[model samples]
Target: MLITGADLAAPALALLDDYEVVFAGKAPSPDDIVALCRRHDPVAIIVRYGKVGAAAMDAAPSLRVISKHGSGTDTIDKAAAAARGIQVVAAAGANAAAVAEHAMALLLACAKSVAVLNERMHAGHWDKATHKSMELEGRTVGLVGLGAIGLRVARMADAMGMRVLAFDPYAKDVPPFVQRVELDAIWRESDVISLHCPLTADNAGLLSAATLAACKPGVIVVNTARGGLIDEPALLAAIRSGQVAGAGLDSFAEEPMTPAHPFHGEPRITLSPHVAGVTADAYVKMGVGAARNALAVLHG
Candidate 1:
């Protein structure tokens, strides 16, 4: 059997229909995943939203492959899959443009207070127009990562006439337009800071309280990466204290944030339902890539 931990685009699932495909159903909790896998004994598991760990892997002796719907493998217990000889594949760079564009959308939204102004305009208020909005040109943008998505963001930032500073120990052959800099300079000088790195044990809370404290006053932050990169409680405290002026967050420490979540009521935060990489074009690419990976493992 083939199984999908979360819903995939119809096209991708259609490719696997030659086999007995099963759905893990909606918003499955961790326990639900183990039960679903054990019940189905899926040979191939495509994990989009659910966590696949040692328990789920151990449940299925026939499990042959595990495919991540996107680039990150932090959600999957990779070591466990390897121990059981299950091939793991990811659709890297499939959504780089979509994610980079979403990061820019968040940056522009925060800089201009576009959402706030639109709401005010609808309320028949024009007082906000008298106040100055933040400008993008000539300001400095510090990037925390320089991978495919981050590189794309760098190009866009340069096109906007902004000086780009970056911190990526793994990156080389630095572009002339992007000045590779240290972390200290990023926090000390940049007006805008964005994160585009993957989540790992070494840097889980890289943007913790101490890091935030070092940022320039009223610094705007945009996170298009994993939610675990920042400590949500500490971030909320900083926002409440007004040290971090505004945030554009596409991911969160927790998914499916409740309506009454504190971030929802904060005016300085702009939220999206983690759709940064879910544009129609990227969605199709990811779906097809994941489907093809599963088929290769199953047939080979």
Candidate 2:
């Protein structure tokens, strides 16, 4: 089996002792990935999502399965893989709890204005009076999607004395502490809103400027899910104008945000480099699951 991205090599090597492994030096382009796959002609290909494309599938006619190192498959061309009779498997649920913890961390940071206040203290400015923070206790937290991560966030928020309101069309029932509401109710009533939905065509740019206009003023927003779910430009405008009090973002529309990014200058925003689910524990679980899935396909 071949691993196409360097980030996955360490984890793959640790968990996949039974397999003969080959590593690509870096994330290869479509053509390079195809050429490499063709040269190896391995029965199973273990790839990091967003690095492999249709060309890789086209290049390896003998490839039976593609094992994803993570959950998201946006980087992979599912249609092409299906057309080629290739099975695609991901380490689903392996990183859910870790990601849920990160989401809650963001929410707490935003509610407390932790980043901005810390910077003020470092600059020798006594801004405690100006940085009056909101308490999570007795506040309403709205969860946009009640999936694995959302459910976990809801339970945590409830335990912290916050009322949990969740909006998930597919979720018929959640914990008794969580009250399922409509999307508009969440927007109108929530003191803090955390997004936990996947990026799909139907929900892309779900949190746009227009949606921000409808939300309660001084609302804290947290998104550890996907970048495309919230419109970046709209979020910037909201933060600047104080329509949104603060935002904690773990992912952005672009990875490794450029130096000129507007959010970099915003004091009301806390940013992380998409490392929410990239924890050591999450990595091991995902790697082991991917290895098991690969072994299953190889033996079958």
State residue 300's C-alpha deviation in candidate 2, in Å.
3.8
> Runs in model 2 with CA error above 4 Å?
7-15
Note the residue pairs that clash in candidate 2. 50-75
| Model 1 deviation from the true structure expressed as Cα RMSD, one decimal place | 1.8
What is the per-residue lDDT of model 2 for residues 1-300, given as tens digits with 9 covering 90 to 100? 877666563665776677667777554666767778889877777775346667888777788888877677666777888888888888777788999999988888888878877888899999856656899899999999998789889889988999999999998668899998998999999999999887787998999998899999999999998899999999889988999999999988877679988887787899998888888888777777777787787778
For model 1, the local distance difference test gives 0.88
In terms of lDDT, which candidate is strongest?
1
- The residue-level lDDT of candidate 1 at 250 comes to 96
lDDT digits (tens) for residues 1-300 of candidate 1: 544454677898788778877777756666787888888888888777778899988888899999877888788898888888999998888889999999999999999998888888899999754867898999999999999899999999999999999999999877899999999999999999999989999989988899999999889999999999998888899999988989999998888777788888788899998999988999888888888888998899
lDDT of 1 at 24: 77
| lDDT measured at residue 27 in model 2 versus the true structure, 0 to 100 | 48
| Angstrom error at residue 67, model 2 | 2.0
